[model samples]
Target chain A: MTISWMDPHTTSKESRSCIDCHTDPKALGLGAGSLVKIKGSWRLVPATSKSRDRRLNIPRLDGFVDISGKPLVLTSRKDLRPFDAAELKRILDVGQCLICHKDFDDKVMKNWNSLSPPKPCKFFLKTR
Target chain B: MKKRTTYLLVALVTIGLDTDSTASYYLGAKIIMGGNNSVVECNLAKVEVAGSNPVSRSRQFIKTGSHCCPFFVQENFYMHPRRRLLTLAILFFSLAFHSLFPCTAVPPCQAAAVDSPSKVSTTASGQIDMCLSCHDERPDRAHGRKVLGCFSCHLGNPLTGSAKLAHKGMVLNPGELYIVSKTCGQEGCHTDQVKRVKKSLMATNRGIISTLRYYWNESKDHDADLTVEKLLKSDLDTPAIDYYRKLCGTCHLWLKKHTLPGFLAEKGGGCTTCHFYKPGVGKDGKKTNHPMITKHIPMKNCIRCHNRSGRIGIAYKGIYEAEGYGTPFEDGDVSEGQLSDGRYIKRLEPDIHFKKGLICIDCHNQKEIMGDGNEKAHFEEQLEITCTTCHDGRQRLEKIFEEDIKRPKYPLLTNLVKKNGNFFLKGKKDQKLHPLHRFLDTACRHPVHERLACQACHSKWVPQCYGCHVVSDKSKDQLDKLSNKQTPGRWEEFRSFMRYEVPSLGIKKDYKTRQDKVVIIVPG
Candidate 1:
């Protein structure tokens, strides 16, 4: 119930925009997933899965489609992990993003802030 | 047939050109030996007399075309003797030689091979690419520095414009195991390296052979102890050879560089093991000549052979190409992972080093991977680098292994050490000294996990496919439904893969010793 999407008064237009939801660390599964699990009587269990996203609170890649029609994004759920310390520059930096994303394309995140709301792209599944 | 004709013509011209003293020469030996033992009446030179010579005789018809004849049999016969004596001597010589060296034809039961061109190049300079006659524009070769023409690697007649003649004795992929030595291990080139590669695990596939043989109990001897040369030369039993040829044969360095329908066309051979680029793609959206011999090797090249069995290179990158999946991830599938041309690849992961722009050669020394020319029983024994070798900068390893990192091993650790004494690696950006930094003082600096390999802790994932089902003879259709490739003889393998991207830790077992060793293992 913490996210805006969870709020009872959330609007349809906001849900449609990928940027409004995905770019947010909390909106994406980056935040601890579902604080409580029902063991017998709704006990609060921390979500400590072994996925890269779980160990470190992060999205590993910037979403961009490649030349031969291959996107660099992790397509499988098994590999969802926090971007390691090494991947920081590649994902966040302006020069590296432009490699595949191109200069100021329509899909470019306005300010392209990862922590901000991300644009709605099906490629970043569950990230939103 | 034409080669024989050409050689015959050459020998005739050579003998014909020398009109000095009388010389009885033996010809047509090559034609006879070329499996063309069909007897033919040969024309021996006539004795030119003064029209009234006392020993004048009719033309002597000599039967020939039986076996291979060396070019210099006329040397000893020039001593003496007149017309009939010389003719009699020459006839006697031909009969003796033909009887000794019989031209036995290949039996009809076995497939008949028409001819085999001599394995000789026209020139030592490695020039003359018949491929260049049509493929004139040399896009880019991996070994461009050598200035060698196409014929250097692809052994075919380069000067001849005719496609068939040019392609004569031409191998589609010189990188294939059968010819890697001749193609890559030429006089001045990768001779020593190719020698070692013939023995290298990647080429010989010693570990896989031993493991499968032991696992199946096919042979008690297993031929594991024999050197690669011995193993190749030794006549293996039918079941063992069948197992090797059908089930496990495709990955060996001898495997040809051709593409199966749903597989990458991995160029298999000595230098091309790491050098020859596969499935070459250009920006123009057209296929180009992918024959490259270069140091700029990508991880995918290693995966072509290493992919299914142990799955080392792909595991290093965290991308497991399980058998169920259609295509193993190429560099295009993982690293550049995407291009803005609205293209994307889904199934892949990069190792931590790869993510940090470190390639396979970054950590592994060339000589170490290629071997220092000494043959070892197991490839694992030859590995030089370890976790401590780079991160720890610790003491020398026991005398069990060699410890020397070649100069310019990689740009990261290439002699460019920092002032604090620890080796420094140049970062991808800003030329930052990404020191092979050891933080022992602050971190847990104990030997708790010293026995564990570097991959034990650092590896993000290890791919383990439970059932590797290879049926030796698909034609037989004798499938042991319960048994995988472990069955004594079967070829076509169809196994469902169970991928464990999560770090899979296991207690290492030494089959040779028949003991459970404490040595830990992941997907390295």
Candidate 2:
């Protein structure tokens, strides 16, 4: 799972893969920001804090898009991990990209000079 | 909620104490900076005037105070290098900040703004009006309400600050039938809908009129409108039209709104009859926000007027309301407050789909409810969405469809793909994994019954009210000379009516085909 966002539960788990956690609707990238299905039609909750704050920060989870340019919007408070501030900071503090994709620690150095944002999936999967 | 009032601080700087010099000048500047974006420096302490008097100097101020919501200074070129540069930079920054982040916009509980004559919020000044001064705590929902403003639906002058003057011509709710076409159904709004709704059977009472006329020997014609709109327009005496006004008109959405505290009088009209009407529950009315706007027009709203007439909406809930409609206090067998928004628990069993939590929208689409611009004389002419349209195809297959796309629940959702006469729902990827009755494809499905309308078998009940009599009496109210339609005091009333709720059962003949017919319907 991607750790660009500040999430604690994603870091605590020992296993982190691209497909596993990304599949869950609760994951930041999976849900269409602010939209929830209601009786087969799209009912917009304009009052939701995410929509009120304006643009949805959809992070680019796929390599085809740039992460910085497309942050998956943090629309609803439901997107936040159901934990207290203290607990969230603990999970967030210990997290880093190297925790899962550890072999690509060398790739971090290249992001500084790269013209565009790094695509983790393309960088690692293409090599494999 | 304790609201935080952001007060605008206006700093007026006037320079020049020394009055003995060689130039004609009277200079004073007013600068308004919101939040912390812009700052003004007024350091010119001394000046000399050659020729102009203090009275003549007033024109140079430019009179820019009108733009102030709280306060907005007009744009002017500054002679000083530092002042000019500072003013230019501040104007640019303030312009961007003013439009994007409205100074008045904040937490609804903590937002406040002075009624500005210039900048209303950040958009149009006269649009939001001074209504925000009092109801400023209420946040504007983003369904184009900011553009439309409070005056759009609620007829009132938002431009005025005074409570009395502002509400001079205000309508508590734009639900009245006579005014609906110009208000809620006004141009750029639901204009087309109001037009069709005026002509629809619900408005025209075509079904009741046509059926009664046919049964009563008034006419042998099958035209639904013959009983109401046709009679109202004809040169015939008041009895025919009054018959509708007393008995049939009560159920139609076009019925005039009355303020009586009873179950029926307080019922809504026009768009509100289906969308936003509800009776007051308690004396204080604290629990009920009467003019509630909701798109999910609850089933209860439909049953308000319908429960007594055809009872079709009530029948959808499987309620066969009692057969007596008499006594002023009690209208029907269903007690007051029993029909609610959340749930209507009843002994009468509803359709299976209703039990499965399928709402009316599952079958009826936009084109069905709101006409397709091409006006039709009747509602039966509009219904095209059906059951087999979704069930007949390869069905709700997961990931892959063996057949093509067929009848979609909503025909107006034209973006959806339909293949080889049928549309199949995709699985987990698109959330179209609706389970289908695969048994429909088997030989035991009875090919001879294939043409039957789905509701003929599926719908468990149809609410029908019986034994309705018309009452003609001179109305207590004085003459209504304005419209000159109804003579003063002369009108009809409906008080005693009987109802019978029964299960729906019928033999389908030539259903869904060229020779479609579902006759032999006992209204009850």
Among these predicted structures, which one has the highest DockQ? 1
Q: Report the C-alpha displacement of residue B52, candidate 1, in angstroms.
A: 56
Candidate lDDT scores, in order, read 0.39, 0.38
- Pick out the ten consecutive residues of candidate 2 chain B with the lowest summed lDDT: B1-10
In Å, residue B238's CA in model 2 sits off its true spot by: 5.6
Indicate which candidate wins on TM-score.
Answer: 1
- Superpose all Cα atoms of candidate 1 onto the true structure and report the RMSD in Å to 1 decimal: 19.5
Off by over 4 Å in 1: A1-128, B1-146, B158-164, B219-223, B226-244, B259-261, B264-270, B278-290, B320-350, B394-422, B426-434, B439-444, B447-450, B466-518, B521-524
* Cα misplacement distance, residue B144 of candidate 2 (Å): 7.2
**Per-prediction DockQ:** 0.02, 0.01
| Residue-level lDDT tens digits of model 2 in A1-128 | 11111101001102222222222221212222232334422222222122233374422222111112232222111121122233222222212233444322244432322234345554334322
Clashes of 2: 23
- Over the stretch B114-207, how does candidate 1's per-residue lDDT look in tens digits? 2322221111111223354355323343333123445656776543434554566777666666686767676546567778777777666665
For candidate 1, the TM-score of chain A alone relative to the native chain A = 0.20
TM-score of each: 0.48, 0.48
Instruction: Show where candidate 2 strays beyond 4 Å.
Output: A1-128, B1-128, B135-147, B175-177, B224-240, B256-261, B277-290, B323-346, B374-378, B395-434, B438-447, B459-512, B516-520
